[model samples]
Target: MRAVMNAILNVVLPVFGIMLAGYLVGRARILGEDSGRALNGFVYYVALPALFFGSMADVPLARIFNWPLILSFGGGLLVTFLFSIAVALVFFRGRFGEVSMHGLTAIFSNTGYMGVPLLQIAFGQQGVLAAVITTVITAVVVIGIGVILLETDRHQGSAPRVIARNVSLGLAKNPLILSALAGILYSWSGLPLPQPVATFMELTGNAAAPAALFAIGLFMVGKSLTEGMREVVWISSLKLLVAPLVTAWLAYSVLGMQGVDAKAAIIQAALPTGALMFVLAQQYGVYVQRATSVILVSTVLSVLTLSALFVLLGVQ
Candidate 1:
C-alpha cells in the first residue's frame, strides 16, 4: 500500500508539477498570447519531430513496428473514433463536419506532449518508443481522416482527386508526420543518426515536454470551462474510461500482448485528448467550446484513472 502511494507520488507529481507551473505562469500573465503560440510552434514543429526522429533512428525496423502493441493501440483508437462519431450523430444531431470534429477530439490522445513525458517518467526512455509510435499513428490516421472529412466538405461536389491532393498537401506540411516517416526510412535503410545530428536532436527534443505542458497551461488560462458541461462530461467519460478498457482488452485477448508491452498500449490509449483537436475544431469553426471543455475535464480525470490503472497493471 505504501509502495502504491509512493509510485503515484513519484510518477504523478513531477508530471502535474510542470503543468501547475505552466498554469501559474499563465495566471500571472508574465507573457502574452503570442508567447504561447511561439512555445506551441517550438513543441509541434521542432521538439516533437526531433523526439520522434531520434526515437526511431537506428532502432531495429521490426522493433519499431512492434505489431502486437500497434494492433492493440490502433484498434482501440479506431473503435473510439467510430464510437464518438456514432454518439455525435445520434445524441448531438451533429452534421458531417461537426461529427468529424467530434471524432477528432475524442480519439486523438495528447501523445506528443503528455504521452512522451508521462511514459518517460513512468518507464524511462524505453517507454518513449511506444509513445512516439502512437503519436505517429495519430498523425497519419487521425489527421488524414480529418483532412478528408474537412476538405470533402469544402470542395463539396468536386472530384475525389481534389480532396486527395489537399490531403497530401496537408500531410506533407505537417512536421510530425514527416519526421516519423523520415525516422522510419532511416531505420529501414540501416543508417545511424550521426553524432552531431543526434546531439542536436537530443537537445531540442528534451525541450518538447516542458514547453508543451507550459503551453497547455497558458492556453487553459482565461478560457471559460463553464458553459459546455454536458457535452464535456460525456466526451471526457468516454475518452478516459471506455478507450483504455477497450485497449487493454484488445491487448490481452486479441493481440496477445502481455507484461510491459500490454501496459504500454493501455497507458497510451488512455491519454487525455490532444489540444491539436482543438486546433482542428478552430479550423472548422464547429464545436470549439465543447472541444476546449472536453480537454480540460479529460486531463483532470486522467490523473485518478491512470494512477489506479498503473497499480492494477503492476506497472508502478
Candidate 2:
C-alpha cells in the first residue's frame, strides 16, 4: 500500500499537476489560444524529437528489440481494433463511418506524449525506449492503416496511392520514427555525441512532457464536456479497459513475458487514444467531435487507470 501510494504521488500526481497548471494557464488566457498552438508546435517539432533522439542514442538496440514486448503491444492493438469494430458494427449499425471513426479513436494511443514519460517514471529508461518503439508502431499503423479503415469513399483515390502517400508522409514528419532512425544510425556509427550538443538536446528534451501535459489540460478546459461525454465513456472504456486487458493476457500467457517488459506493454495498451485521431478527423472531415471527445476523456481517466496499473505492476 505504501509503495502504491508512492507511485501515485511521485509518478502520477506530478504529471497531472503540471497538466492542471497548463490547463489553468490556458483558461486564464495567460498563454492564450495562439500560445497553445505555439506550445504544441514547439513540443511536436522541437522537444519531442530531442527527447526521442536523446533517449534512443544511448540505449542499446538489443534492449529495444524485445520481441515479446513488441508482439504483445502490436497484438493488443490488432485485437482492440477488431473488438472496437465489432462493437461499432453491432451497436451503431447504420452509422458505419462515424462508428468506425470512434472505433479507431478508441484503440489507438498517444504513446509518444503521455505513455513514454509515464512509463519511464514508473519503470525506467529501458521502458522509455521500448515505449518509444511502440510509438513508432502507433504512428505508422494508426496514420496509414487506420486511415484506410476509416475511409469509406471508393472514389477518394486509388487505394495504392493513398496508402503509399500516407506511409511516406507518416514516416517523414513523425518524431518517433525519425528519432528511431536517427538513433539506429548513431548506434551503428558508434559515435558519441559532443558534450555541448548532448547537453543542449537533454535540456530541451526535458521540457517536452510538462509543456505537453499543460497543453492537454488547457485544451480540456475549452471542450464541451457534456456533449462529448457519451462518446468519451464509450471510447475511454475501449481504450483504458478493454485494450489493456487484452494486452495483459497476451503478454503474460501467450508470450510468457514478465517484469518491466510485460508491464510496459500493458500500460501502453491502456494509454488514451492518440490525439492524432482528432487531427485525422479534421483532415478528412470525419467525426471530428467524437474523436476529440474520446481523446480528452480518455486522457483524464488515464490518470486513474495508469495509477492503478502502476500498483498492479508493483512499481516502486
Candidate 3:
C-alpha cells in the first residue's frame, strides 16, 4: 500500500503537476500566445531528437532489438487501430481519410512527451529504452500507415508513384525517426561519444520531458469539449481503456514479457492520444474536432488511469 502511494506521489504527481503549470501559464497568457508553439517546436526539433539519440547511442544493439517487446506492443497497437477503423466505418460512415484519422487517434500514444518522462521517473534507463522502442514503432509503423492512407485518400486520382513519393518524403523528414536511426547506427559502430558531444546531448535531451508536457498543457488552452461529445467519448474510451488492455494481454499472455519491459509497454499503450494526432488532423483537414476532443479527454482521464496502473504494476 505504501509502495503504491509512493509510486503515485513520486511518479505521477510531478508529471501532471508540470502539465497543470503549463495549462495555468497558458490560460493566464503569462507567456503570450506563441509560448506553446515555441516550446513544442523546441521539443520536437531539438530536445526530443537529442533525447532519442542519446538514449539509443550507448545501449547495446542486442538489447535494443527486443523482438518480443516489439511484437506485443506493435500487435496491440495495430489491433486497436483496426478496431477503431471498423467503428468509424460501420457506425460513423466515415470517409477513408477520416477513418484513418480515427484509427490514428485511437492508437497514437503520447510516448515521446509523456511516456518518456513518466517511465524514466518510475523505471530509469531501462524504462527509457522501452519508450524508445515503442516510440519507434508508433512513429515508423503506425504513423507511416496513417499518412499513406490519408495521402491516398486525398490524392485518389494521382498516380501511385506520386503518393508514395510524398509519403516517403514526409516520413524521411520526421526528426524522431531520423535521430533514432542515427543512434542505432552509432550503436552498431560501437564507438563512444566524445565528452563534449555526450555532454551536449545530455543537456539538450534533459529538457524534453518537462518542455513537452508543458507544451501539451499550453496546447490544450483553447480546445473545448463542447463539440463531438459522442465521438469524443468513443475515441477516448478506445485510447484510454481498450489500447492498454490489448497491450497488457499481448505482453503478458502472448509474449511472456515480464518486469519493466512489459510494464513500460503497457504504460505507453495507456497514454493519452498523442498531440501529433491533432496535428495530422489539422494537416489533412479530417476528423479535426474529434481529434481535439480525444486528445483533451484522454489526457485528463489518463491521470486516474495511469496512477492506478502504477499502483497495480507495483512501480515503486
Candidate 4:
C-alpha cells in the first residue's frame, strides 16, 4: 500500500501537476489563447521528433523491432477501434465520418504527449522506446485509417486512389514518423552520433516531456462536458478501461511480452484520448462536442485510473 501511494505521488502527480499549471495559466489568460498551439507545435515539430530520433538512433535493430510488443499493442488498438465503430453504428446511428472519429477517440491514446512523458518518468529510456514504438503505431495505422475514412465520407464521389494517395502523402510528411524511420535507418548504419549532434538532440529532447504535458493542459482549458454525456461515458470507458485490459491480456497471455515492454504497452493503452482526435473532430465538424467531452473527462478520470494501474503493474 505504501509503495502504491509512493508511485502515485512520485510518478503521477508530477506529470499531472505540470499539466494543471498549464491549465491554470491558460484559464488566467496569462498568455494568449494560442499559447497551447504554439507549445504543441514546438513539441510536435521539434522536441518530440528529436526525442524519438535520439532514442531510436542508438537502439539495436533487434530490440527496436520487437514483434510481440508490436502485435499485442497493435492488436489491442485494432480491437478497441473496431468495437468503437460498432458501438457508434448501433448505438448512435453514426455515419462514416462520425463513426471514424468515434473509433479514433477510443483507440488514439495520447502516446506522443502524455504517454512519452509518463513512461519516461516511470521507466526511463526503455519505457520511452516502448512509447516511441506505440506512437508510431498510433500515428501510422490508427490515424491513417481515421483520415481515410473521414476523407471518404466527405468526398463521396472522389476517386479512392486519390484519397489513398493524399493520405499516404500526409503520413509521409508527419515529422514523428519521419524521425522514427530516420533514426532506425541511422541505427542500421551502425554509426555513432557525433558529440555535437548528440548534445543538440539531448538538449532539445529534454524539453519534450514538460512542454508536451503543459500543452495538453493548455489545450484542455476551455473544453467542457456540454453535451453527449452518454457517448462521452461510453468512449471514455473504452479508452480508459477496456483498451488497457485487452492490451494487457494480449501482452502477457497471448503475445508473451514481459517486463517493460508489457507494462509500457498496457500504460499506453490506458492513456486518455489524444488531442489530435479533437483537432480532427473540429476540422471535419463531426462529433465535436463529444470529442471535446471525451478528451476532457477521460483526462480528469485518468488520474485515478492510471494510479491504480501503476499499482497493479508494480510500477515504482
Candidate 5:
C-alpha cells in the first residue's frame, strides 16, 4: 500500500506538478493569452523535433531490429485505433475525418510526455527500447494515418491531383514525422553527430516535457468544460480503460512477450492522451473542445490507474 502511494506520488507529482505550475501561471496571467501559441510553436516545431531526432539517433540498430516487440507494440496501437474508429463511426455517425480524429484521441497515448519517464523510473534502461519503439510507432504510424485522413478531408473537392500533391507535401513537411525519419536514417547509417550539435539537440529535447505541460495549462485557461462532457467521458474511458487492456492481451497472447517487456508495453499503452493531439486538433479544427476535455480528464485519472499498475508491476 505504501509502495503504491509512493509510486503514485513520485511519478505523478513531477509531471503534473509542472502542469499545475503552468496552470497557475495561466491563471495568474503572467505570459498573457497568446503565450500559449508561442509555447505550442516551440514544442511543435522545435522541442518535439529535437526530442525525436535525439532519441531515435541514439537508439541501437539492434533495438530497431526487434521485430516481435515492434510488431506487438504497433499491433496493440492499431487494434485500439481501429476499435475507436469503429465506435465513433457507429455511434457518432460523423464524417470519416471527424471520426478518425475521435479515434485518435482514444488511441494516442501521452507516451513522450508521461510514459517514457514512468518507464525509466520503473524499468531503467530496459525501458528505453520499449519507449523508443512505441514512440517511433506513435510518430510514424499513428500520427501519419491521422494526418492523411484529416488532410484528405480538409481539402475536399479539390482536384484529385492537387489533393494528392498536397497530402504528400503535408506528410513530408510534418516536423514530427520528418524528424523521426531523419533520426532513424542517421542511426541506421551510424553517423556521428558533432559534439556541439548533439549537445544542442539534447538541451532542446529536454525542454519538451515541461514546456508542453506548461503550454497545455496556459491553453486550457478560459476553455469551457461544459460543452463536451459526454464526448470527453466516452473518449477518456476508451483511452484509460480499453486501450491498455487490448495492449496487454496482444503483447501476452499474440507476441508471446513476458516479464518486463510486457509490463513496459502495457504501462505505456495506459498513458493519458498525448498533448500533441491537442496540437493536431488545433491544426485540423476537428473535435478541439472534446480533445481538450479528454486530455484534462485522462491525465487526472491516470494518477490512480498508473499508481495501481506500478504496485502490480512491483509485486510481479
Candidate 6:
C-alpha cells in the first residue's frame, strides 16, 4: 500500500500536474488557442526527436533487437488497432470517418514523448532504451499502416498518387523513425558522438517529458468536455485496459518474453492514445472532438492504470 501510494504521488501526480498546468494556462487565456499547437510542434519536431536519438545512440544494437519483445509490443498495438476498428464499425455504423478517427486515437500512443520519460522514471535508463525501440515501431505503424487504414475510402475512388505521396512524406519527416535509423547507422559505423554535442542533447532530452505533460495540461484547459463522453470512455478502456492485457498475455505466452523485456513490452502497450491522432483528425477533417476527448481522458486515466501495472509487474 505504501509503495502504491508512493507511485501515485511521485509518478502519477507530477505527470497529471503538468497536464493540469497546461489546461489552466489555456483556460486563463495566458496563451491563445494556438499555443497548444505551437507547443505540440516544438515537442514533436524538436524535443522528442532529440530525446530518441540521444537515448538510442548509446544503446547497443542487441538491446534494440529483441524479437520477442518487439513481437509482443507490436502485436498488442496491432490488436488494439483492429479492436478499435471493430468497435468503431459496430458503434459508429455509418460514420466511417469518425470511426477511422477513433481507431487511430485508440491504438497509437505517445511512446516517444510520454513513454520514454515514464519508463525511465519507473525503471531507469535501460527502460528508456526499450521505450526508444517502441517509439520507432509506433512511428512506423501509426503513420504508415494506421493512416492507410483510416484514409482508405471504400466508397470513393482511390487516388494512388495521393496515398503514395502521403506515405512518402510521412517516411521522410518521421523524426522518431529517423532517429532510430540514425542511431542504428551510427552504431554500425562505430562512431561516437562528441562530448559537448552529446551533453547538449542529453540536457534537452531530459526536459522533454515534463514539458510535454505540462503542455497537455495547458492545451486542455478551456475545452468543454461535455460533447464526447461516451466515445471517450469506451476508447480509453480499449487503450488502457484491453490493449495492455492482450499485450501482457502475448508477451508471456506466445512470445515467451520474460524479465525486464516482458515488463517493458506491457508498459508500452498500456500507454494512452497518442495526441498525434488528434493532429491527424484535424488535418483530415474527421471526428476531431472525439479524438481530442479520447486523448485527454485516456491520458488522465492512464495514471491509475499505469500505477496498477507497476504494482502488478513489481517494478519497485
Error of 6 at 24 (Å): 2.4
The TM-scores, one per candidate, come to 0.80, 0.73, 0.78, 0.76, 0.90, 0.79
Name the better of 2 and 4 by lDDT.
4
Question: Sorted by TM-score, highest first, which candidate order results?
Answer: 5, 1, 6, 3, 4, 2
Per-residue error for 258 in candidate 3, Å, reads: 5.2
Residue 100 displacement in candidate 1 (angstroms): 2.8
Give the alpha carbon lDDT tens digit for every residue of 181-218 in model 4.
78879989999998898888889977877786677677
| lDDT accuracy of residue 255 in candidate 4 | 80
Counting clashing residue pairs in each candidate, in order, gives: 0, 1, 0, 0, 0, 7
lDDT of 2 by residue, 1-316 (tens): 4644454345455656876797788788886577755666777678766866776676566666768887999899889888877877876553555766866887788786677766776668878777877876676556556555545432236587775676566556556557656866786677887888789778997887677666666666767656857556987898999989999999999999888888888888988776556545644556766776676677778878877877787776
Per-residue lDDT of 186 in model 6: 76
> Weakest 10 consecutive residues, lDDT, candidate 1?
4-13
lDDT of 6 by residue, 58-95 (tens): 76677668788789998988888788889779876646
Scored by lDDT, model 6 comes in at 0.72
lDDT of 1 at 40: 73
Residue 54 error, candidate 6, Å: 2.5
Candidate achieving higher TM-score, 1 or 3: 1
Best by TM-score: 5
* Pairwise TM-score winner, candidates 3 and 6: 6
Candidate 1, residues 31-126, lDDT tens digits: the string is 876776777777777887897687667566776587888889889988988998888888877667877777777777877766766677667777
Better of 4 and 5 by TM-score: 5
Candidate 3: C-alpha lDDT: 0.79
lDDT for predicted candidate 5 compared with the true structure: 0.79
Query: How well does candidate 2 match the true structure, expressed as C-alpha RMSD?
Result: 4.4
Q: What shift in Å separates residue 82 of candidate 4 from its native position after superposition?
A: 1.3
Candidate 5: C-alpha RMSD to true structure equals 2.2
The global Cα lDDT (0 to 1) of model 1 is 0.74
